[model samples]
Target chain A: MKSGTWRISGRETSSLPLFNTEVMGVAARRTRGRRFWSNLVNGPAARYLFILPTILFILIFLGYPLVQSIYISFTDASLLRPDVNHVGLKNYAQLLSDRLFWLSLRHSFQLTFTAVALQAILGLGLAVLLNQKVPGIQIFRNIALVTWVIPIAATVVLFSFAATPEYGLFNVLLKQIGLGDLQRYWFGNRDTAMWMIILMHVWRNAPFYALALLAAMQAIPQTLYEAAQVDGANAWTRFWVITFPYIRYTLGVMIVLHVIFTFNNFEFVFLSTGGGPVRATEVLPTYIFEQSWQYYRLGYAAAIGVAMMLILLTITLISVRLMERARRS
Target chain B: MTMRKIGYYSAVYILLILSFAFLLVPIIWVFLASLTEPRQITSGSLWPGLRSLTLDSYRRTLGSADVRIHLRNSFVIASMTTIATLLIATLAAYSTSRFARISGASITVVVLSQMFPYVLLMIPFYQLALQFNALDSYASIVFTHVVVALPFSFWMLKSYFDNVPRDLDEAALIDGCNYISLLYRVILPCAAPGLVVVAFFAFVSSWGEYMFASILSQSKQTATITVLLQGYISGRRIEWGLVSASTILSIAPTVILFALTQRWLVAGLMSGAVKE
Candidate 1:
């Protein structure tokens, strides 16, 4: 049978709305089941399904290589060898004293920081200036994007030639303009080579940041600007109070993305100088290449690769966290 | 708000024009240098003596020193990779957009993969290539290039697919259309512009790629245009005429493509960033 009714103190259960309560409970359970099914059958369900192939593609083709590289970092693997020996921290320990490795690491950091900072600053400036509604403005904006669109290899070669010390156009132009002292081996001198790399990086990458920021700027509702103006805010005040806060998140994302791109860049430096003039321009990636391919030190190169990955992973994590926080706040 | 306004507008215009000049200078220099004779280029003057302008540099660069082979290789590799990337990326994007519940994990994988930055993997990829006896082959470069381009293309196409209305698919299905026809007849047409954008990006990216080409392609038979240009620049002595001329030629296609798709490119990028 069923459970007994309550005593007089808590009785009157039968007098309660038992039918309604039971009906409501059953409806709630049914609604939960329908929700689960709807999520499985919705448009986003298709998106989730389609995305799986991409995930698998990246994992097998790219992820596997990354894991393999990390593993090789701890082993004595060479290009010519058929087998790898577990060397534990030997490769890492050797890297500690490797002068060239240190130099390359220094160069990578210098180049990454300099290029990213300059790019952000210039990009921000351009984005702000271009955000104004001026006539024939789209034409100027298009021209600004030219550098970013052109193939990097082409720019690298062109700049290398243009900045050439002897017969380069820049030198000739300077000499003609009476700045005869301004000309020197642009990509040849150790002191100037890294600067040239940073400059080229800035020139090529600044447009991308500008474009991203401009998009973010355009997304801000115009009503806010009108409200700011009504409150007696000047252009500068309006930007500082309204525009900056809205796009700050986009700026952070751009910075992180550019840092990754700049740190991993090898094309321009390699094309221009080949980490030359006595390895002065040798960034980490180039150093890895030299070790593995040029010197056949595959194991040591893998170690360098692992270290670069760790640094990049750390940067990426911090970037993602900042991005998430920015979104939330 | 009268004459003062005119003056301010003119000043802004002038500043923008100057910035454009800076942007165009390097490319203009290449074009001008390409037209100049070696003798004039050596003199380092912008005004190539009208009399000194010649096609000699172009002829020399395109000559049988195997420049043609490199051009062909570049075309074959870039085109093949583009096709492969579009095929794989489209399918994956379709599956993702049509079926996936949360793109959180998938998008993360794609973004992180991109974060790896091809440079870090160069050594290991090379070692693997050698192990598989795939080094120095066009297929090797193509396979590697596919990997390089797939992530970006997938991300791009997926975002594009997201813009399509779900009702389009549902309507097609209701009208007795299968998934294949729905994709081909309806969704593909809808996503045409985005597909073009993705394909062009993949093509240019593969074409301009230098590091892997330098490492993997052993001879002129497998060389791409970028590597050839690098060789000209880095030889025992610089061939300024050939280097500058070839550089101009190499950039011409991309420049023209960007110019043609200028409007679409801006719109595509803007939409992708903000919406997705």
Candidate 2:
């Protein structure tokens, strides 16, 4: 109570200066009068005018839709119906019971793991290769990012076309190479569809990761390597002790972003398989489409949407925290 | 020891060569098939048989009733989106960096919006677009694309602008230059490299976008090249020749654009993670 009373006294004392300045200080009043209206009309107002459009766009397009999806998660809504029937947790309950949902969830995890793991490993390996100042190496580096440049939808269609069992270029090449018997259906069957999609995803994304990591790697100084070499360290030792540690944080961030991108991707899978021959390759995005658009069960799809958001949120938080902590140290 | 080094070099070369071939094969196959007559694909002869080469698929895909209109629509939408996004993002990022601080909540919202699965936005955005009476209009496509592409451009340009020395602005102010003239004459020219990267990325993204274009547009007048490509390939009886032809054509402009601006792309893409 004493401290509170003292703070009130301090504020009252500070306010007395303004009143005295207003009454007795003509110079101060003139300066304040000149700046006040202009500041009000120009400075703060202009700043807000600059900021408002972007904020409004984000809110209406991104924010509103996210909330709507959450609302839909609670009710029994479908694409065919205009009105949603409130069913509370029933849709989520149904999602838990649905076998296809579980399977797609598993497939989504599988896709993310395989794609990210291979992309990271191969990307790092390739980055290391190109980091050497080999002759004509710049051309190879130029070609490396081409896969990333290709559209995902185009890549999917091309790969799907290339993997066709009968007239596929892959099958033809295999047959010519004496593996005719093993030329199986790449996207026509359940067993191989997801695997093929995973391969395509890796092929498309690995170079992108390599480029990102390569850039990170180049930022490391040559002095460290020279010092290591002077200390009689071999290539392997120098790499492990220097290069690996240097790019580790960047790699972690890239991996998390890759995970999120791969997890949310729709065009590649949708174009290649449309979640079937038998719903074998359906990840969460395609699964949501199947539920909401195909089967017209919007609420159940929204539940899946919520689950996806939670999973992605957990992954992102963990990744950012882990990498950021390491960065600070 | 010298022999071992040569062998290692050869092995590496072989691996790289094989990987390059693997990467280019599908793309080459598409090109070859585009030249092959539709009948020959079913005949199962490879290499276009050296005798099956024709421009029938290209003629068909490009000369279709709706192809030209769709291409025009795509060009208009993507071009508009690119120009508008660049303007808004450049201004917004400059203001956010220089004039005022964007709150944590705003940052969070931006990040979350970017992370949002396009699938989740499909229905709601569509509903909103229709309610606003923007359905099947170029404005709808352009606006939706601008929203999607703004964050990237803003973030890219902001990071680049932040690295710029503020002394330039202060010096301009001392010289009695206003903010507008300073930005145009000084800041923008200094940020040319970043602007190129932002513009290229925005254009490429808007060019290649499929999901929104597919959902939001139904008629040829508003449909994009990707949607048109889908139309050619949707039936059970896939028109492999025509589909391949159109796909190749669709990518041609972008491929050329990237090839020309590869230096800037590498610099920009690398800059996000690479701070040298």
Whole-model lDDT for model 2 versus the true structure? 0.78
TM-score for all models, in order of appearance: 0.88, 0.89
Question: Which TM-score values does chain B get in all models?
Answer: 0.94, 0.91
Provide the interface RMSD of candidate 1 in angstroms, 1 decimal place: 8.7
Q: TM-scores for chain A, candidates in order?
A: 0.81, 0.85
lDDT digits (tens) for residues B1-276 of candidate 1 = 699788878877876767666678888888888888987888866687789999998988878567778888988998998898888888787776775444687667766776675775676567678988988888888878888888767777778888898878766654544345567788889998888888878888888888888888988888899888887777888778888777887887777878877766765765554343
DockQ of 2: 0.33
Superposed Cα RMSD, model 2? 5.9
Model 1 segments more than 4 A misplaced: A1-56, B131-133, B270-276
Q: Tens digits of per-residue lDDT for model 2 on A1-329?
A: 23213111112223222213333334434776744543443333555566667777777777788888899899988878788789989988888898888998999999999999998998898888777665677888887877777666678778877887768887887887878887866987889898899889888878877778788789899999999899999989998999998898778877877888889988888988888878889889999887777787878887898888888888888888888888888
Per-prediction DockQ:
0.30, 0.33
